[model samples]
Target: MYNLLLKEVRLGVNPFFFVLPLITGALMLVPGWLYFIVPLYFCMITIPNIFGGYKSQNDLMFTSMLPVNKKNVVQAKVLLIVLLEVLHVVTAMIYGKISLSLYPHLHYIFFKPTPGFWGLTLVMLALFNLFFISMYFKTAYKYGAATLVASTVAVLFAVEAEWLGIQNQFVSDLFKGSGSTDGLTHYSILFTGVLIFAAFTFIAYRIAYQRFKKVEV
Candidate 1:
């Protein structure tokens, strides 16, 4: 299992992806931008490229030649995906803090780059992985439909949330309003979102494992 994971790190994922967080996370520094879309773009660009490389490399066929089983292959790949997602979120958070420092009084038409906002980003990514990874691993080749459906759902979540934030003052205040008392509630929502993302990834891995087991190569 360790060897397979190393293979995934060394060969499965592109070296370019390692630095992509730095690139995409910079978007958080853009003042008054829709910050939620930074992580979404990370998913949109990286995931498809990762799987596209897999198909072009005939990675499934090549990996099947090795000693590892399908479950471990799936597990290692999913683990890599999770790691990348974490990288994206953490880097974006740092830039978000910098954004706050630079523009302390900036008003937002959409959600602020708060911990709660990242919590919501995690939920969006969870929906994306629930659809993208599970469906992509079903064949280990085709990812277009999976990517489209997953990306659409994630994008729509952000767009609609922004719409709600704009149209509803309560929602806007909930996301962007200043309230010292609501910090606890904000963190609680963040924690719950993390838990939900973990659950979703677990289920996605299990389903992908079973699905990949049946693929010929």
Candidate 2:
């Protein structure tokens, strides 16, 4: 399982995508910019590119030739996706810190990233990953349509959530009112979001394993 994961990480993911977190993270320095958009863009570009490329290259055929089980293959792919998401969030956090240090005055415009944002971002990414992994594996050989649909759906949901004032309620309060980290009820939401993401990711893994197991290649 570990070897299969390493293989996928080494062969499937582009290095450029890895650095994207850092690039997005640096956007925190921009005055009056929405920092959340950085991570959203990270998800938009990376997930589709990696999974879509795997399907385009017929990666299952080559991978099946190796000794790994279909379950491990699915697990490895999901693990890599999770790892990438973690990388993006951590890098963005670090960049947010640096941005504040460099321009203290601009800090007032940008609320310090709290646990609430992290929790919400996790939910967002997990929701997208569930759709992306499930759809991509359904037709592993033809990723173009699946990738487009999944990516579009994820982006639209995120955009709509922001536009509808769902994602911003906490942030808005933090910036406009006396919302403190201690006062926010993010831990419960964060815990719940983590559990939901884990459940959905597990479902996605199972779907991938089943689909890949039936593929002739």
Candidate 3:
């Protein structure tokens, strides 16, 4: 299982992608921006391209020739995706800290790149993975429809959250308004959201694994 994941890091995923999430992370430097989109951007671009690399390199065929079973392949690949997603979030969080420092008085209709916001970002990506990986593996190579639909769903989640944050004064205060600096109380929601995100993504991984295991390749 570890070796299979190493294959993805060493060959399946392009070196450029390891650096690519930083581009999305760099969005945090843009003060007052919709910081939530940074991680979503990571999903929007990274996931499809990683799968594309797999096809271009004939990864499915090559891996099938190995001694590993389909379940381990699915596990390693899903794990690779999860690791990359986490990297994107951590990188963006660092930049988010910088953005806060750069603009201590900044404000936005969208949620700033707070820990809580990253939690929501995780959920959005979870939805994307639930749709994208499961649907893509059903055919094992066709990712276009899956990517399109999944990305759209993730975007809709962000848009709805932003819309609500804009209209609901109390919610806005919690994430984007004055309540931001309220310390532990302000971050309680963020921690809970992260935990929820973890649960959902774990479930999504199981669903994707089961679906992929049924594929002939």
Best-fitting candidate, scored by TM-score: 1
* Candidate 1, 1-217: lDDT as tens digits: 8888888889988898989899999998888898888998766899889888988998878889998888888888888889899999999999998988998998887788887887888999898889888998888789889999989989998888889888987778878887412778778878988998999989988889889888986
lDDT of 2 by residue, 44-118 (tens): 678768867887777878988998777787788889988988898888867766765676544344344556556
Cand. 2 Cα-lDDT: 0.71
lDDT of 3 by residue, 1-217 (tens): 9998998899888898889877878988987888767877766688888887777888888999999988788788778888898899889889998998888887676887676676677778778777777777776777789889989998899899899889999879888877777778647766776677677767766777777777776
Candidate 1, which segments miss by more than 4 Å at Cα? none
RMSD of each: 1.3, 3.1, 1.5
Query: In model 1, what is the error at residue 215, expressed in angstroms?
Result: 1.3
Off by over 4 Å in 2: 100-112, 164-171, 174-176
How are the candidates ranked when ordered by lDDT, highest leading? 1, 3, 2
Question: Order the candidates by TM-score, highest first — what do you get?
Answer: 1, 3, 2
Model 2: colliding residue pairs = none
Best by lDDT: 1
TM-score of 2: 0.82
